[model samples]
Target: MRTLDHAACARAIFESIGGGENLVSAAHCATRLRLVVADAPKVDQKRLESLPGVMGVFCAGGQLQIILGTGTVNRVYEEFIKLSGLPGAPAAQKCTAPVLPLPQRLVKTLGDVFVPILPAIVAAGLLTGILDALGRALPAVAAADWFSFLKMVSGTAFVSLPVLVALSSARVFGGNLFLGGVVGLCMVHPTLLNAWSVGTAENVPVWHLLCFNVKQVGYQGHVIPVIIAVWLMSRLERWFRSRVPAALDLFVTPLCTVLITTFVTFTILGPCFSFAENCMIGLARQLSTVGHGIGALVMGALYPVTVVCGLHHMYNVIEAGLLSAGSLNIWMPIASAANFAQCGACLAVAFKTRDPKNKTVAIPSALSAALGITEPAIFGVNLRYVRPFVCAMVGGAVGAWFGTVTGIGATAYGVTGLPGFLIVGGYILPYAELLALSGGVAFAATWLFWQDVPAQDKTPG
Candidate 1:
């Protein structure tokens, strides 16, 4: 990236994508340069990828996104606006990405909301893993006062997820942050019976609203309900602020927002969306159990596709739910397979390529993949030779099949490929087996099927 001029990269993108005439809007989200273009078909994807500092390019949900990695996207985005000089598109309010269809938007929104909260979740997960490992070695360590404190530390995220979601989702939907926390707290109030306990108890307390018997349940580990609740709350808060006189706004806004949000969440949103959340969770769990190895194979194969579409982070929600429910995140091993397979595919390309320039790119890309970042390998090397990319997916599926049969999982959400060993949760033997097999299969497949690389591709810039 040091060799890549930010302005040059921006110009390359703008010129390749039909310049300001084509860009409907532009925005940056962490890594990707998210843009809404007039016509996706007009974009020259190869020229864009061929440019320095560019990682990958894909059109998904009607957005032409350039994956430029973190720390660099901001510079590129800034240069883009400065060069293009597009008008009336304020960075904050202007549509950055496409207005996706409702279902995709909903999933994307939920994933976006959870991403900010993942650091806490990951820390909690790792803490639990550490405690579990330590407890086995020293039984008395588990009973210590410090250990009790540590248990509370790790449990806080799962126990109070609503507040976390509320805090993040409120910001996402343009609501007052503190008020969102208030709404979240109302759902998980100390007086209320926990949401998890609702299923076990008979004849639980309820508040009737319309046709729905809204149970007085604490939303301890729920995600969707809190998000929907906060979104509604944000809208209500803004509406009140708009109608109320300026002098009374300070008092009137928070009061109406809290009252309406609390009543609506527990009564309507919580009870209703909880069912949907449960159904989603049940589906995920069902996938694991349906045909055992079949689930792992499917998840593994499709995992890379999600990465390609820039939607892989969505799995964090599902993984968090699985960890919160019990001991393991069964889906982690499937991801492990996908990641290691990419590494092997890239390495095979490095070994097979006759060109010095191709080898220069392929070797480092493979090493980067081994370290848990696959963008360089996927976009820079394996993807150039389409056969290797396809081989990697097949290898991922094969490896995950082994993982499901042996039942391995990871403790943390992010962390895979070779670094996956650090977070491997349930069993070591099976996890190692999965990695070994996934890499081996992908490497073999690439070597066997990807025997020919175009001469022109060998002289890559």
Candidate 2:
């Protein structure tokens, strides 16, 4: 026996999973070592679970995840990558399974695309919130000449969002990064009026295409069109690479691919997709107005499904638009409810579990969930038992209804659970009430209905 040394165990895991050659990418979230591998079936699940340090193993979101507590997973991950000899873990993380339905695959694709950029967006959102709160409290600063400079810190990321999305999307879609960047920049070109400013004018400048005229608006914070354009560009670039002669391929492929893609973007992709995007935004707004908080109830119940299905990143579009327009993100409260519900459920499991190892894992995971990181609780504790996860969702739905009826929202983009109080700020009272409604109900229900599964490792040696 290896006696569970982290490095030696990591090496065993690497080898058992068909070695570094089989690995397409490596990443971790909270408490799990997440891998997107070439052959998931080749990995020995029983052998992995039997490993001394590993707490659990499962596949979700097209990822092979090994749960090793948060602090422990980081150390093991560092060792695993060092042994694999990969360059600083795979930066291009796109999780997909041929076996999955198209909708699920799309969800994973969208999540992977935004994961790299979400942190910056979240930071910008927090900065914006802080400024908003400060400006209200201190009128002097709001009137200062340099207030715009302060706004820029938070405003720049959201305004130039397409560029950030472009950089990531090109890599994920296998297109030329430089060309993709150029396309994104073109969408937000200084010459074109900002997307938000379009409404202020009776009629903005128009571009005449073959059939119709476009509003000559910048994409600014839009999501879907930039993605569609990049996907088309990547496909075109690949097609050109195959046909063009090697001598001509270098220059011809780059120039011809980008030129064709750019032309199609202005004439077709941008305008059509922008309309579709606006319709979706309009639908979300309408849902907010739906009677008796029904939309909130449905969204709260389904929000956890997004996390499970890996579609949660799709909300980045809606949330960004809301914050940019000065309305706080309505989704944030639902997110808080869903996230804290998981924490409540996890804590319930911790209190009920008799096994020392299960107890050890559940306690910290609950803490992580309350702090606005829920995967540790979701994967390691609540979902493992099944019943608690359901209880959490029901609780979340109830909390969400309250939040919606009260019109509670958060100033920031990403923070959730207890820590969301920072962004909830003025909305804290109602937000905290929602958390209590969600978490208290979830914890009590889970505690009453759930029981711990006996751990084999807990048996006496």
Model 1 spans with C-alpha error above 4 angstroms: 1-26, 29-31, 35-47, 70-93, 96-99, 197-213, 355-361, 457-461
TM-score of each: 0.85, 0.87
lDDT (Cα atoms) of all candidates against the true structure: 0.79, 0.80
Residue range with the least summed lDDT across 10 consecutive positions in model 2: 87-96
lDDT of 1 by residue, 1-461 (tens): 24668988899999999988988878766567878888888899878876777766766666777867667788998899898776423442246434566656666676778878878977887787777777877889999999999989988888888899899999889899999998889889988888677778886787776776777778886777888999999999989988999999999999988998888787767778888887887887777656968987888887788877657866776776676665578788888888889989989988988866566667767776776677767766777668898889998999988988887777766667776665664476788888889989999999998875566644322
lDDT of 2 at 295: 87
Residues 1-461 of candidate 2: C-alpha lDDT, one tens digit per residue:
22347898789889878897788778876578888778878898888866766767889756788887757788888898899776534442533356567887776667667778878877887777777777878878987768778788887887788888888889888888999999889899999888878778787898787787777888875788888989999999999999999999989998998888888988889989988887877787667657788888888777777787667877777776676555678878888888888888888888988877677778878888887777778777777788888888988888888888988877767788776776765676898899999998899999988866567643211
Score candidate 1 by lDDT. 0.79
Error of 1 at 49 (Å): 3.3
